[model samples]
Target: MPTLQRVPALVASGQLAIPVAEALVALPADVLGRVQAASIDPDLADTAAFSEAYGFPVEGGANCIVVAGRRGEDVRYAACIVLAHTRLDVNRVVKKLLDVRKASFAPKDEAVALTGMEYGGITPIGLPSSWPVYADARVQDAPEVVIGAGLRGAKLFLPGAVLAGLPHVQVVEGLATPTPDA
Candidate 1:
């Protein structure tokens, strides 16, 4: 775990993206209490770098990836959270779930623009209500996990159970596969 000062995410407004801060403020007190925010170097915000620099295990980091599914003229967007050590099964599981012929990572510019968050700091907490959040079942097995704070300069820490219970989040089995060498 990071030794950095942890504060209620709701009050860490300056360290969080505007949408993320607002989202935390809207959560119930009990749910809000379980989430904490810590500041980090923007340069090391990526999972592998942050984990190694801060002494947090890479596996304890959850990555929120924006995905787009296209069917005819309709395009649906979703967020998929998977452990840093694993690979999201975007081509199979996500494609099937979205009921689309093709599903893939959203373009960086589009993701950042749509989420109002930095490219490397797109967290699921502040995503649009219409977007489904697919969280890998394995995430709930961890006591706690670190995720982007919607800003590269900070990160959020919360109980895995809390994450699974978040609004619009669906715990999906086999949403991800372990990386070959991870």
Candidate 2:
């Protein structure tokens, strides 16, 4: 059986992985300064488990994502962030925001391929230059929040104000919700 690879840490804390640490180090000094992360052994696939395991508080963290769609012959990609408490209206809000006939979550494989990061590890800071990112206003209200650092088993804690400073990050609202099946 193949052995699972562990993440490296930016700092020698023996907690998270190194690449995640590198990214945190690379963040502009003007942005939120580095903060500590809590280690957990659970699949943070959803908000509840993610919040519970990390103890970072869902009401504070922002749900960042990459959304894409095609309009006629044009394909577009967008980096979007939503608050854990309020879901973005993918159809009504994103469709209108992108001004495309159809909008959908970017294909999982395509996202992983483009980012060179695991499914849950993708973050806006290291994405391709073409990505247009959007952040919700709520993120600006928190003192510190944890977000993916481009890998599972790793996360970065920074002030909410720092995420607002990313280029092309628009303050949006209503990106996701507890759907009947979700």
Candidate 3:
């Protein structure tokens, strides 16, 4: 395991955290210390690569992302967390729930550009302050889930309950469905 930095020392005290990277810095100290970071391909989006390279099962990992959609006049951003074995149907489920005309995965370039985190490494633990987060109910039942460490080749293993404490998370049951092969 790699070195894990405790939250308090890694983050400035009393600063309203932004960027999933900074938010991760706000996690409980004990949990923060349990995380590890690894470096991998910058553009890798699929979980198989992350699993193979990191020695974790792709289908058993957590998939965390921030999505962009229109809600009235606002360009709303919401974080969606799912199991790697399942796929979140952004158009049917996410968009309709947001009451928007369209909701798509944040464009690859846009995701990388805005989060300042690599595409394969986007994790909900630390995300921009403006984004709302949603976690599929299934994830909460897992013994442990692997999430990006805001960087590639690196992932964090934490108890599922920690995700529920995120300020903006809304637990939903149908955010994702298991793939046929899974």
- The numbered model that scores best in lDDT is 1
Candidate 3 lDDT over residue span 77-143, tens digit each: 7779998888897888889777788787888788877777767777776566667788988887777
Q: Model-by-model lDDT, in order?
A: 0.92, 0.64, 0.68
* True-vs-predicted CA distance for residue 74, candidate 2, Å: 1.6
Query: Residue 159 CA error for candidate 2 (Å)?
Result: 1.5
* Stretch of 10 with least lDDT, candidate 3: 8-17
Model 2 regions more than 4 Å off: 1-26, 32-42, 173-182
Q: Write the per-residue lDDT of candidate 1 for residues 1-182, one digit (tens) a residue.
A: 54678898877889999889888888999999999999998989999999988998898999999999999999999999999989999999999989999999999999999999998889999898889999999898878999999999999999888998897799999999999998
Tens-digit per-residue lDDT, 1-182, candidate 2:
21223233244234434444555566656552444454444367355667775455777666667788778998788877766676666777787778888888899999888776667756665677667777776777678666666666556566777776665577765545543443
Residues forming the 10-long window of minimal summed lDDT in candidate 2 = 1-10
RMSD to the native, candidate 2?
5.5
Model 3 alpha-carbon miss at residue 53, Å: 3.5
Show the lowest summed lDDT stretch of 10 residues, model 1. Answer: 1-10
TM-score of each: 0.97, 0.75, 0.77
